[model samples]
Target: MSLIYEARSSSSLLVAGVARGLTTQGGRLVRPAENCWHMVVVRQGGEASMRLVGPWTGAGVASYGEGAEILWIRFRLGTFMPGQPVTGLRDQETLLPAATGHSVWLNDAAWPLPGIDDVDAFVERLRRAGVLTHDPLVQDLLHEPGSGLAPRTERHRLLRATGLPLRHIRQVERAQQAAALLGQGVPIPETMFRLGYFDQPHLTRALRRWVGHTPGQLLRAGEEHLPLRTRPLDAPSLH
Candidate 1:
């Protein structure tokens, strides 16, 4: 795997992180299940294109072309487009039509494709245009389950904003925690106990479903194949 991947924390409220990489030789990677949505820009053969990838429900394989340059913008949960409900994009992708070599069509407007250095500014423009927004209701529910809102309303708001059930997000988060622990040389039983899993089998199942790797595989596999978490987006060093 000749993949050179480097991700950094973002200071933007609407973004979780930004990753820029080069796939020197075409290869596949294990993409873990995620609650947050993403926008990916690819530049190869002197052609640029963009795509909106919805929140993934499970682990899968992602392929890249040789010498492909990639910039991935991961949006924080609860951030969404106004008219384009994320519900319809779950587990799928929408390819943004190219307006020019350097821009794409979004909301019937010509939006410039963002380079890695200018992504924060691009996101700010989206916010100013009312094209991207964050839902406080969803954030509140995620932070505190015992919200004042009715159960039905909470579910509706969560689904509408993130296109994912609360339970699904929790499961994915737990699985990620487990993967992090296991990758750091923690024992399986200890990881299970620390994370409140029932047993080894339970931990194994969760990892396989959400992380695409069993506990054993995570320990044995190289870091290149692991779908791992980057640094927190609010880390002071990032700013």
Candidate 2:
């Protein structure tokens, strides 16, 4: 895995107690097969695809529109009750999913979901409605937990325990161009093109979701520090 992870989350009024973070490409993340939930607003570029290799879930191996890039608007969901067969994604622009109360699942797409465009405005509108709230863990994550992500030693247990899927196991096979161009502080449009994303908006949205911060915001945040694995954007990927 060679992705640069910058986790920043602010309290918004839409998702109440939920927090958002950003993760940049360069590494790998492997998710388990359990009945978990996620509200993911993701974007894709190049030949990227997301899949779920498990049983007892909704769709698996979901491929988006084949463009150089694709943007996403998603959310993390949990079980409202003890056992409800995980189902399809939400199609409308409503802030009822998080408000309805579920479990905390990130990047796992086995529950209510929407597209990049659909949930984009919805998040903004919900902020106006005083719905989501930022989480407080952003500060420590900003330090880039030197230990890395939590290891899933109990996949079978969690699968037997939850029934959906675990967080998508991110495998850092490609260095999506965002890390490259953004490293130079280039305008998002050029970076977007370099990353194969459809446009600036798509790139920006992904930056916010995975990395928990925008491209420029990340650059600014790192102005006073250096990463343990820091290297130039033009450098070759480490995977």
Candidate 3:
């Protein structure tokens, strides 16, 4: 069975999607978005039976499983592969960017990257570091998602300093804090108290506006990408 494993974009410099346990017959996808830079990883889970269908068409795909459950992951950096066209043009394209608060599907020619080996191995380094799955609350931010995303197109002046749009930095930071807290399974009521919201409703509004979903939705999205791990909630002082 072929399916998208997970998809999500945080208020950070990363946007990601993953697929696992695809059918032996390799699948194709046409992406119609301008991803400044990103990585694509392919991991072998079981029954190494798949192949790329276009562009570098007929190229022999790497084999994983049996001898070893091969995990392949691709890394695409915004600065590195600036607007690299998606090659293996397919018929279906269904992806949406979480930030920018807008989404579009391309009817134009979509070029996707060719094949590769184990996607998991690429992430193994992050796994070992206390960084990957290390922070639980990164996803349960207490502020608004829309607050930061609306003004953060790389075309801004102030955003460059804060690494995010200044018009919405404070809100994004708060939401980031809340996301971190939620990942630890911290109760929402208590989080509201800690974040100084008038009530759950107030926080809920912020969550919806800034993050594109409720706190629970943020956590689920993170979980779908990878199991969130816990850590000390030493958020920076709100000076």
Candidate 4:
């Protein structure tokens, strides 16, 4: 199986990236822990579907047929569709009704799906239509890490913008970081130390829950040294 991925450039502050990919010989795709939401469009043969994926706190699996073309806009941690709170969609996938000309319904209005090259333009259109908006405090808290906002106030702002607690976000980030380190051939014990895990078992539990792999399995797969920088969390276990 082969897959090609590209990160599209975007100017919208709410969008993290517009990622486009094509999978030939598709099978199962494992989505690891993450804090952001994804607006995904998948096309197989002549049929296409659009959906919104909310923050995933644990590992999950998805399957696609061969020759599937997928395009997704991954929103930044603290952004969501206006009038649709992400908290309601946490750990869930909500399908959007398809409209004419490859468009989809968002808030009962038709939203045209732009080509990979037109992501910035599409975002601009959403902004003009008042369908995309974000809380300014999220940017402030993210960029100004040292902001002295009161703890209670900061927590409220974070919940409003990201639909998740700070602790959950940290857990997801740490789990992803651990996966990257393992893919680089780091030993589990060392990775645990580096990431401040309590012990090997602690690391193992986090990986199993968030990355869907045990350390030993990840290490064995790393021996093949695949070109893909990111390891597939769905990789089979050695045990």
Candidate 5:
């Protein structure tokens, strides 16, 4: 059987989005590189597990078990858990220990496994408890680079908060924009010019590395391209 997936936008500033997937039979899916990280909960065979997934820089394949249900809380860039530094989480995951059937150990306490409807409240609790935070400077610097901090300090803070350098994050974001445009039937030359890619091959290579599909493939793939959210081409930040 094929896996079913759904996603919804979140109102919380700390959250980028939320998504859930279910698999009746085991299968592999193409997971695209992401600009932000996520906290994922998986249920299989009557057991539940919570894991912190980090930002990915390249395309990868993820395997799901038969009869698996997964929920992902995709956090915004620069939001991270205190003590569970995002730096060490790049391209990897940290599986939290189960404190009980309904909760897991995080930041020295039990955090209940949240259902789909409870995500916002759960994140609010983490923020109140000092387990979740956002680095405003890092996010601000990315937009226009006028934080007033020394170059070295800014670099350190960026790496610590997002687990990738400024350039990589921008590149990933750009590639995602390109993919979204191509998927929406925009011509290749138009996409290249709109997003500031040097040429068609430059756009193609970036898409292949980050989106796991070439321009033509993305046009053909449509909404079935990746498991993550496809950003809007007109999003103000992309320009």
Candidate 6:
């Protein structure tokens, strides 16, 4: 859980971040549900592999190696590479073909992986090369709270941008919010009411699907001081 460096993209259209870290001990860690896709590069024993982690609907466990160097780039919700559509990657992990230690083949070209400090520049290159793009309507819909478009139009736009239905997005968002509140020691009844769940069962279903943990499990983990990596990439602060 030790992070060596972390940074976010400077571009407004690309709400993403990069983190590099090393694990002190090797074991399974809970990777909570996330809205964005992750491009991870790991190096161990003089070997490296690049993998793409799609938006996950449920929490999962991932294994890391002790003292391994891990670097990852998490893309924004509505942003994606042209050839690699977000829809195809949903709830799956795909290994990217590598051209070199610091480069991968993307969009029929060799894309040199940028270091933490050069993420913005790399995004700029993607923009110029037509590799990175997002729907303006999707951006507006996510940031504006509400949109005036017709229901059908809004659904279509969201699907085109995020490759998932609005209901799915709301479920993940609510589940994450609930997990955050629970981690903060909020009472279960209060959390249910505040999150607009119909009842305890309703809340439990959402948490089980999106959070991969029940309310009691989350609470116990918090009380027992278990390490859970549920922090959203867009959080203003990093640890």
Candidate whose TM-score is highest: 1
Residue runs of model 1 more than 4 Å from their true location after superposition: 222-239
Q: Write model 3 residue lDDT over 1-239, tens digit each, in one string.
A: 12323222222322233322232334332221121123322334422222211111111222222222211232222111112233312211223222222212122222232232223443343334422222112222223343243343432322221122223445654665775676677778887878877887787777665444566765555433222122222432111
Order by lDDT, highest first: 1, 5, 4, 6, 3, 2
TM-score of model 4 (CA atoms): 0.83
Tens digits of per-residue lDDT for model 5 on 108-217? 99999997678999999999999999998777988886688898999988887888889999999999899899889898999999999999889988988998889998
lDDT per model, in order? 0.85, 0.34, 0.34, 0.76, 0.84, 0.74
lDDT of 1 by residue, 64-178 (tens): 8887888999999999998788887789888999999989999889998998779999999999999999988877877785688789988988898899989999999999999
Residue-level lDDT tens digits of model 2 in 66-146 = 222222222223221122223322211212223212222222322333332244455564334443333222222323442
Which ranking of candidates, highest TM-score first?
1, 5, 4, 6, 3, 2
TM-score of 6: 0.82
The residue pairs that clash in candidate 4, if any, are none
Residues 1-239 of candidate 6 have per-residue lDDT tens digits of 43333444455366477776656567776667787887777776776777778787677877776667677788777887777778777789888788887688877898876655676777788888998887777767766766898878988777766778877777899998998888788989999999999999999988877777888887767533344233444554432
lDDT of 5 at 41: 94
| Candidate 5 C-alpha error for residue 232, in Å | 17
What C-alpha lDDT does candidate 4 achieve relative to the native structure? 0.76
* lDDT measured at residue 232 in model 3 versus the true structure, 0 to 100: 25
Cα RMSD to native, each candidate?
Answer: 3.8, 17.0, 15.5, 6.1, 5.7, 4.3
Winner by lDDT between candidate 4 and candidate 2:
4
Total clashes in model 5, counting residue pairs 3 or more apart in sequence or in different chains: 0
What stretches of model 3 exceed 4 Å from their correct place? 1-164, 196-198, 215-239
Tell me which residue pairs clash in candidate 1.
Answer: none
